[model samples]
Target: MALFSARRGSGLAAWLLAGSLACLLLVLVDASRMAEERTRERAHGRALVARVGLTDLALFNEARYTRHLSQADRHAAFQDHPGALEHFPAGSLAGPARPSP
Candidate 1:
């Protein structure tokens, strides 16, 4: 007598498919619930911005040049020397600042 039979109809594949479907359903349900909450949060954020007048979002805390991309100077990253390599990790991730019109 074999401990496990090769012809056994355990339906393991069906069970895995059903489990994945259940998880997907839970994610969709959670997203629907959060949609309403996000709308309210966005409105609150807008009101706060209007009242406090917030500045640009800080992208990286590593260096001053990488902190605010909009206000960052292109040459600020090369403070050490003109041909010096970027010391900050965030500097490589961020592209050059947009030219002012």
Candidate 2:
């Protein structure tokens, strides 16, 4: 009876140890995968920001060109008819007004 009990106790301890090791390994693998995912997310965020910045630069260039053209047109209009400005409204020289929502 004593021998049987000792053998049973040893078997139980081995089983518990194996289960604990398995759980530890699983946790380690999950943690590693999470770390990799975070790294990928950060890279994607950086790429997105770069793309947005490039788009903003292009828009800024286009706006600058439009502004230059509007200024030129105003100058030409005033030069062509000096008295025409006095007959027009106050905001007439500012180009077409933006439509309200």
Candidate 3:
């Protein structure tokens, strides 16, 4: 009876250890997946910003050309536009609508 009890305790301990390890592995996997998702989301956001910037620049250039402005002048005009400058935050990843000091 003593030997049987000892064997049973060892079996239970092994099962608990295995369950704990599996839980840890699952947590680690979930963390890794979250990290990857965040990275992809950031990349997608950058792509979108780039696309919008390019489109805005193109439209501005077309308008400038229609008004007979030189290429350099058009570039300057786009930079001087308030709406274009506010597309991104001053120094953060947040989008526009930041409160003025």
RMSD of each: 5.7, 19.5, 12.8
Better of 2 and 3 by TM-score: 2
lDDT of 1 by residue, 3-44 (tens): 333345445555667789999999999997899999988898
By lDDT, the better pick of 1 and 2 is 1
Query: Model 3, residue 32: displacement in angstroms?
Result: 2.7
Stretches off by above 4 angstroms in model 2 are 1-7, 44-101
What clash pairs does model 3 have?
none
Candidate 2 displacement at residue 92 in angstroms? 61
Worst 10 residues of 2 by lDDT: 54-63
Clashes of each: 0, 0, 0
Query: RMSD of candidate 1 to the true fold?
Result: 5.7
- In Å, residue 38's CA in model 1 sits off its true spot by 3.1
lDDT of 1 at 21: 100
Predicted model with the maximum lDDT: 1
- Model 3 over residues 1-101: C-alpha lDDT tens digits? 45334368786777788789999999998998999999988897679868775332222323343223322333333354523542222212212233449
3-99: candidate 2 lDDT, tens digit per residue:
3343697867777887899999999989989999999997876798787753322222223323343333444334445434532343254444233
Residue 47 in candidate 1, Cα distance off native in Å:
2.6
Q: Is candidate 1 or candidate 3 better by TM-score?
A: 1
Against the true structure, what is each candidate's TM-score?
0.62, 0.35, 0.34
